[model samples]
Target: MYKLLIRPLLFLFDPEKVHHFTFSFLKITLRVPFISTIVSRLYQVKDKKLERNLFGLTFKNPVGLAAGFDKNAVLYNDLADFGFGFIEIGTVTPKAQAGNPKKRLFRLPKDKGIINRMGFNNKGVEAAIKQLKNNKKKVLIGGNIGKNTQTTPENYTSDYTTCFKALHPYVDYFVLNVSCPNVSSHAKLEDAAYLKELITEVQKINNQQNIQKPILLKIAPDLNTIQLDEIIDLVNQTKIEGVIASNTSVNREGLKTSTEKLDQIGNGGLSGQPIKEKSTQVIRYLAEKSNKSFPIIGVGGIHSAEDALEKLEAGADLVQIYTGFIYEGAGLVKQINKAILKA
Candidate 1:
């Protein structure tokens, strides 16, 4: 029904616009009596086998909605009805800023992918905190936080520290986002020394609190083996909780999209099917090299139960979806959980 009826209609409008419209649509329709209950019954699969206890929090399932989808905390409870075990909100910055220029988001339907240079556009963390405080659902939540666009590399620690502290009480875990290709100067923070310093600083703050929340790193899929090795080493050294194996890829190879149209789409990180293999390779590498020393949340281009299984086989403790959800709809979550149960 989604691909045949809803997706086609949603796909007709601008990708970003459609995102907003769908959120609004869900927000209103979900408020109708028994709507959420019906959605939960249809989408949610309850089984002890699907539970994942990681970072001291229990996930109802391993399938999660990736960060950019619920950039703010507005739709998490509504989206949780779609059967995701968890929802990651925000690549949120400390201060509100408009991300890159218009048309920073594009769809590569032929490739079953999306190219976005959204540059961490989000309402400031304060607004998200208000929403988080009001959340009525028991679904697990992860906060993917980043420095503002104009923040300097030297001052990056403070930005992350600010967000970490602000969101600590609300989020189940925190993902330090330092690998978004859309943000200029942000990738430099991925340097081993820089990452180690940043994580250590955030860890310092976490330890000060009564209960420390798990902190994870989100990396790009484009890194070389050596870079990934460094990242693994940093994770071990920093004692950060885990890693979210990818954000998106700057590489455009193996895409089925036409060159002319892609050129028009321009510079941005590419995600979806074009990234599945690459992201899986990164996860496999990190898990093997580290001897599975730490947990990894696998994401990028998961469009089916098979795709989710491949990540789990390759050593991901859990998995997430964005583009796949866009292409496959809410049923993908149930399919993944059922596959995990069958396996």
Candidate 2:
């Protein structure tokens, strides 16, 4: 029904606008008494056999909504109705800022992908906390945090630290997002020394907190083997919780989308089907290198049951989706869960 009726209508508008409209509609519909229960029964696949315990947290299943989808931490409970075992919110910063200029988000429907230069456009950590605090669902929530774009690389630690501290009580886990290609200076912080320092600072804060939440690093799929090795070694040394293998990639190679059209879209991380292999490769690399010592949350290009299963087979302790959800709709979650159970 979504693909035949709903998606075609939604596709008529700008991708980002349609996204907001869809969420707003769902939020409104979900408010009606018993609607949430109906939606949950339709979408939420409950299979105890698919349950997973990762990073000291018990997940109802391994499938999760990747960070970018609910940047401000809105719609978590509503989204959980779609059968995701967890929902990661944000790439949220310390301060609220409008992301990139208009058209920062684009759709490549033919390629089953999305290109977004939405430079951490979010309502900031404070607003996210308020929304999260009201969440009624039990699904695990991972907070994906990043520095404000205006903040310099030198002061990056404070930005991450501020967000980490503020969102500590609300989130079940943390994803340090130093690899958002859409932001200008943000990706520069991915250097090993800077990452080490940033993680160290956040870890210090985590230790001081009453409850220590797991911290995971979200990295770009574009890193070289040496960079991957450094990250592996860093994870071992820092004692951080885990890693979300492969954020959206800056690389646009082999895309079926024409260069002229893509250039028109300009710069942003390319996600969806184009990223699956690269993301899985990173997951495999990290898993192989770490010998599964560190948990890996596989993300990027997961649109089907096979994709989700492949990631699990490749070494992901769990998996996440963004473009996959856009292309395949809510049913994707239940499909993945069913696949996990079958596997």
The numbered model that scores best in lDDT is 1
Model 1 Cα lDDT, one tens digit per residue, 114-165: 9999989999999999999988766999999999988877788899999999
Task: Tell me each candidate's TM-score.
Answer: 0.99, 0.98
Angstrom error at residue 191, model 1: 0.7
Model 2, residue 158: C-alpha shift (Å)? 0.2
The stretch of ten residues in a row with the least summed lDDT in candidate 2 is 182-191
lDDT of 2 by residue, 214-269 (tens): 99999999999999999999999999999998898889899899999998999888
Candidate 1 regions off by >4 Å? none
What ranges in model 2 sit over 4 Å off? none
